[model samples]
Target: MALTTKVAAGFGGMALVLMAGSGIASAAPDDSVIVNSTCTYPQVIAALNAEDPVAANALESSPMANGFIQDLVNTPPSGRQAKIDKVRAYPAAAQFSGLIAQVANTCNNY
Candidate 1:
């Protein structure tokens, strides 16, 4: 899958947790926090909206996003880190690394 697709999947999966209100503890604002299921939908969206409205909008409105989310949701929480780690390991991760960090940093405040 394309790197963007992978990211979309990751975010989509996270979105599910957000909607479910997983109530996970706030993680330190960093890329690693992207795998955390605790960050609420509002918190993540707000962070994304503040940092990159376009990406935030895409996340909210993208049709393929739901499929991506479903893919992530199917994975067990214990394995999410591996999935994220694999994505991060991709060279493409450098391009959106900052965006991920920004979301994590802002959302962790909630």
Candidate 2:
């Protein structure tokens, strides 16, 4: 009986560990882009739009792809207009339409 109890306890402990691990995994966001933030770009965009539609529109309309903006972070743009125009062209590029816009935008800032 004592041996059976020990075995049952071991199984329960293992089950607890597994459950805890699953919980931790589930807590992670599937689409988070910020290094430590839970917010995805879509979520951040939504928040920005909510806070200021005009600013959000400007950001969306800006030619810089999201990715390019991120990419140019350290260097920024000496010629801002030119940079925007170039990045905006990415969406028109065949490989960068619709959902690709997100990646392009993300890379813009990379």
Candidate 3:
């Protein structure tokens, strides 16, 4: 579930971090040089909970992704129809529910 993403500029455009929970990082390929990193749903919640700097850097790098996450948190979908409606309203909402579920579950210690 790793996704190569864009990082905040200060980390250097060429730098791609990791969230495998191993703390190891590597350089992004030339074709995907803009990618900063990717992680499973749980890894992100864990990293944020632990106050890990890597997660902080990644979010800072991508304002779009960060904003998307913030919007989901502020207004959650009701159900399948709600999710479908979200997609109809904004395409990115499709990813929102799963992320919110994972985060909410983790927060509830599920």
Q: TM-score each candidate.
A: 0.54, 0.30, 0.32
Per-residue lDDT of candidate 1, residues 1-110 (tens digit):
65456556546444222121123333323424555555555676777788888777666666565455445545555666544544433443345555766676677564
Please, what is the whole-model Cα lDDT of each candidate in the order they appear? 0.53, 0.32, 0.33
lDDT agreement of model 3 with the native: 0.33
Q: Give Cα distance to truth, residue 67, candidate 1, Å.
A: 5.5
Which stretches of model 2 miss by more than 4 angstroms?
1-35, 68-110
Any residue pairs clashing in model 1, and if so which?
A: 24-38
Displacement of the residue 7 alpha carbon in candidate 2, Å: 63
- The C-alpha stretches of model 3 lying farther than 4 A from their native spots are 1-52, 79-104, 108-110
* Residue lDDT tens for model 3, 29-91: 321212222333345446444544464446545765565444333332222222222223332
Which numbered prediction scores highest in lDDT against the true structure?
1
